[model samples]
Target chain A: MKIELDNLTVSYQRHPAVHHVSGRFMAGEATAIFGPNGAGKSTLLKTIMGLCAPDSGRVRLEGVERQAIAYLPQQSEIDRSLPVAVLDLVSTGCWQRSSWFRRVDRAGMDAAWQALETVGLADFAHRPVSALSVGQFQRVLFARILTQNAQLILLDEPFNAVDARTTEDLLELVPRWRSEGRTVIAVLHNEEHVKQYFPQTLLLAREVIAWGNSAEVLTDDNLHRAVDTAAHWLERAPVCHVDGSAA
Target chain B: MTLALYDLVVSPFVEFGFMRRALIACLALALSSGPIGLFLVMRRMSLMGDAMSHAVLPGAAAGFMVAGLSLPAMSLGGFVAGVTVAVLAGLATRFTSLKEDASFAAFYLLSLSMGVLMVSRSGNNVDLMHLLFGSVLAVDDAALMLVAGVCSVTLVTLALIYRPLLLESLDPVFLRSVGSRGGLWHTVFLLLVVLNLVAGFQALGTLMAVGLMMLPAITARLWAANVGAMLAVACGVAFASGAGGLLLSYHLELPSGPSIILLAGLVYLVSLVVAPVGGALPRYIRARHRQL
Candidate 1:
């Protein structure tokens, strides 16, 4: 599906976190949003996903036959200490797809199992996520995404800090998603990965500083500017921190 | 009616009319409090319930001043006042950039002092005492109906939004993705809490209403895993505590509300050390055992 975020501006308490940003992410494209520490990449994604409202922008998902969207929030969004089992964690993804008030059905459980299998978490399906390694948790999150069967996927910093193996596993999954006609958007600090994997990029530092092919947006000059000027101090909106572990 | 054959268990529900009334009130409090309390603990709004319950005292006194011992009229005034405090507290949290508990504390203390002043100025000792300790035996049919109606609305609303609410409580940002309005749900959940606390205030007294809501739910959390099981266990314990306390109070002829609250508190105290999972001592023991 093609999604458009036109003139999107997200502000908090009169301070503009995301100032007048516009962009379009087409279907079957793996889009990467990158900036330094504080650039409003996460804020922009939040606005687009309808988590936070943009002061003046419209976000629409079009050109997709499927009506479903799967959202995989950053790892920081979940409490690591929570004793929830992996299967139950994935089952929550069905919250959006299933009807309200009704309990998760057999099909939902089946989907969760399938997603866990896809994420190589078939064995950890019954284990508590707290027991899993960091990479395991990320895969668990991916399993949640798989459960939704969403044509459009928005992931916030999927590869924030991980060993090479986990990164490679996730990097390999992106093209597979694109091959399957699924759209993926990930916010990241890693710039080289953009050229290596994703085809499109929306580089931001409080605004869309550059947008186009990965090679063009990941230019060293644009990269430094995005990090030093806009991103150096903006990502921690305080409102977005679930448990004060924003760093 | 042969009173002797039923005398052992019948007195609580049948022998003395006042006892029957207290027992029934306890039943309502128990059921209403279970699901309500579970969410409160899960959402970290236990203290908010306390703040709101205390905030209504001044309003309760105001109601008494206006209506002169009229139950419905006073309850309406109290309910309005409680809802106002909850909303204002929410606004203070959202607008002033103050933390939620801090704002709740400020509002509660202010309301508490004001309530005490109003009671002293406008109400006599007996009215203030009744409002504080509550006399559930004196609860009329109208009050019973009101509690029942509020319970039905709350239960139905809770049922309708259970999954989204659970999802948000567990991981709100995740809920927000794929089109969940976590903020909106937060407001709605808080609203439900206010309504339930206010409804139970008549039987529980403004002072003890929060205690009644929190203790059983907290205790239940110690006993089980999963939202559904926690809710059921909480309700069971809440009803038992309320009913047992009611029967005890009636047999002994004391204030029913305080009795029920004390009973709920008693359950909490037991759960605090011995509950299956989260209880402090039991958890420590389990950890030590695992180490061994």
Candidate 2:
């Protein structure tokens, strides 16, 4: 699916975290969003996922319903200490197919088992999430996203705090997803990983700094400019208007 | 032997009408509040449970003042007051700079003072004590019926919202991403807490109602490994403690409500020290082995 952001602005408590930004992520393409700290990459992803509304403007997904979109927030957002079985957590991905009150059918359970096997967590299916290591927990999360079977996947810092082996295993799925004509947008920090895996790149510092091929967008000049923009943006004061309209 | 067993264990319940009434009421509270307590502990909202119980005080006091110890009046008043504080506290957390726990504390304190003032202004000291402590032994048919009705409603509603509620409590961000409204489920869960606390207040009194919900659930957590098992263990502990507390009250001539709560406290302390997995005994043994 092709995703479009049109002059989207996200503000918290009247301070704009994401400035007026516009871009389009082509279908079947793997795109990476890079930014300095507090550059609003996560905020932009949240707005696109419909979890947070933009202060002004719109995010449009061409020809795909909102439910077809899957989101994997940062690992820190999940409460791993909860006493939830791995299989039970994975089965929740079928929330769209099953009603809230109904039991998971045999077919759904099989699908959850298959997802677990794919993530190399079949043995841990009955184990509580708290018993798993950080890497295993990340894989379990990926397994849940796989069960979502969404055409559009948005991941925020998917590799953060994960081990190299698990990262490689998860990275292998991204290109395969692209091969299947699925759209993947990820917020990433590692420049080398982005250049190796993602074909398209959007460098943002509260606004789009550069958008194009990974090799071109990752230029030393653009990286410096992104840092400069973030530094200056925080220092700049808000302009007061007589009519009191500022977003 | 059978006669001896019956006399030791079943005689109090079989022989005394008040004991029978207390047991039935205790069972109703256990079956309903136990699961709610499990949820509360799992969600790390045990303090919130205490705050809400205090918030329920004014409503029950007002009900007593107006209707003279009528069960429905007191329960309805408590429900309204608890729900109002829960909603306001939630909103304060969302809109203001205060955290949820802080907001709950502030609101409950205000609610508590207001309730105390209203009670003192209208009723006698004994009336205040009854509202504060409770009168579990003197449970009438009307009070028992109210507890039963609340339990039925709580079970049915929890069943309908079980999956979403579990998901919301464990991983709310994921639930929200999947198009399930986590906030609505949260509100519903809060509503259940309020309803259960209101039901508990009639027998345990507002002062000690949360003990029935929190202590047994925490005790169960020391033994059980999963959510379902924890809930079942909590109900068992609650019921067992209720019976034990009632027996202690009968034999020793102590007040019933405080006796029941104190028994639950003793059970929690025992579980903390001796439970096989997470308790102190195993940890101490492991330490000794390591030293050896």
Candidate 3:
């Protein structure tokens, strides 16, 4: 399903993290949200996921319910030290199928197992999540997303702190998801991975610096502008009152 | 020797009706509070549980002032007060700049002082002691029934909300993304905490009520590797501590509330040293083996 952002602005305490920017993510398009640190990439994703309310404007999901979207949040958000088994954690993705009180049926369990197998963590299913390394844990999270089997998938810095081998292994799943006609939006820092995998890119530095074709968005001039805009940001800048002027 | 062992343990529960009632009440508290406390410890809200126990005081005191030592009045009051404090803290955390722990601490301290003052103004020192420390041996049929009812409701509710509750604790953002309101589960959990604290205050008093909840949960963390195992271990510890504490109080003529809590505390300390999971002795042994 396509997601349309209509002049969205998300601010924390009056300082806008995501300025008024409008865009649409087409259905089945694998897009990389490429930006420097603090460029509102995560905030944009969160707003789209309806976790953060926009200060102005709105997010419109076309032909899909919010529940049909799968989100893989940053690792820091999860309590890895919790005494949860890998299988149990992965099975949580079947929550939509078996909401609240009902037990997950045989099919759901098999899906979870299949997900674990896909992530190469099948043996670690019964082990406590705390016992897994960070890379392994990320895989387990991916496994959970696989169980979710959502039409729209949002990944917020999914490859951070993961080993190169694990990163490559997980990165392969993006194209596979895209091929399956799932819309994949990912916040990523690695330019090579972006250029290699993603056909479309949104270069953001609080506002859209560039959008569309990855090669066009990742041009030297655009990349320099993104970094320069981010570096020269004023912390106490006045609120944007002029409509479309700031954009 | 066998007869002596029986006298030390089983006879107190078999012979005296009060002791029997006290044991049953404590078991009920243990049964419910163990799982609730496990979640508290899991969420790193063990101190929140303590704060909630103290927050129950002013309401129980208000009830006592109005209706004497009536079970229904005091429990209702305690439940109301505890829930009010919890909700206020939750709201403050949501709207204001104050963090959750700070808000809870502020509210509970205020509640504690107010409760102490109210109790002292209306009743004598002995009555105040009974309110603060509880009288497990003096538990009547109504009080026993309330505790049992709270326990049953708590278990059923926990079972109903178990998956969402776990998701809320472990990954709140993910829960929200998947269309579950984590705050709803959190509020429900807080309600359960208040309900348990109200029931516990009847038997263990406001001061020691959280002891049976927290101590067993913490002790279980030292021994168990997963949530289900942790829950089982916590309930087991709570049961053992409750029965042992009752026996200790009976044989030694100690106050029942402190006796129960102290016994739980003792178990916690012993578990800290010797539990197989993360306990000191096991870690030390593992370290030694690595070196060897």
Query: Which candidate leads in TM-score?
Result: 3
lDDT of 2: 0.87
Candidate 1 colliding pairs: A38-A231, A38-A234, A38-A235, A39-A231
Q: Kindly list the per-residue Cα lDDT of model 3 for residues B1-292, writing each as its tens digit.
A: 9999988888988899999999899889989999999999999998898899899999999999999998899999999999989988899999999899999999999888999999989999988888889988989999999999999999999999998998889988888888988999999999999999999988989878899999999999999998899999889888888888888888888888888888889989998899999799988875534542
Q: What TM-score is obtained for chain B in each of the predicted models?
A: 0.90, 0.95, 0.97
The reply for model 2, stretches above 4 Å from the true place, is A234-236, A240-247, B1-5, B287-292
lDDT of 1: 0.76
Q: Which candidate number has the best DockQ? A: 3
Q: Count clashes in each candidate, considering only residues at least 3 apart in sequence or on different chains.
A: 4, 0, 0
lDDT string for model 2 (A160-229, tens) is 8888889989988899899988899999999988999999999999878999899999999999999998
Give TM per candidate. Answer: 0.85, 0.95, 0.97
DockQ of each: 0.36, 0.64, 0.79
lDDT of 2 by residue, B1-292 (tens): 9998788779989988878988999999999999999988888898888999999998888888889988899999999999999999999998888988999999999999999999989989998888888888988888899889988998989889989888888888888887888889889989999999998888888978899999999998898888888889999999888889888888888988889989999998999999875689977876534542
DockQ value of candidate 1:
0.36
Chain A TM-score, each candidate:
0.84, 0.92, 0.96
Q: What is the DockQ of candidate 3?
A: 0.79
TM-score of chain B of 2: 0.95
Top lDDT hit: 3
Candidate 3 chain B, which ten residues in sequence have the lowest lDDT sum? B283-292
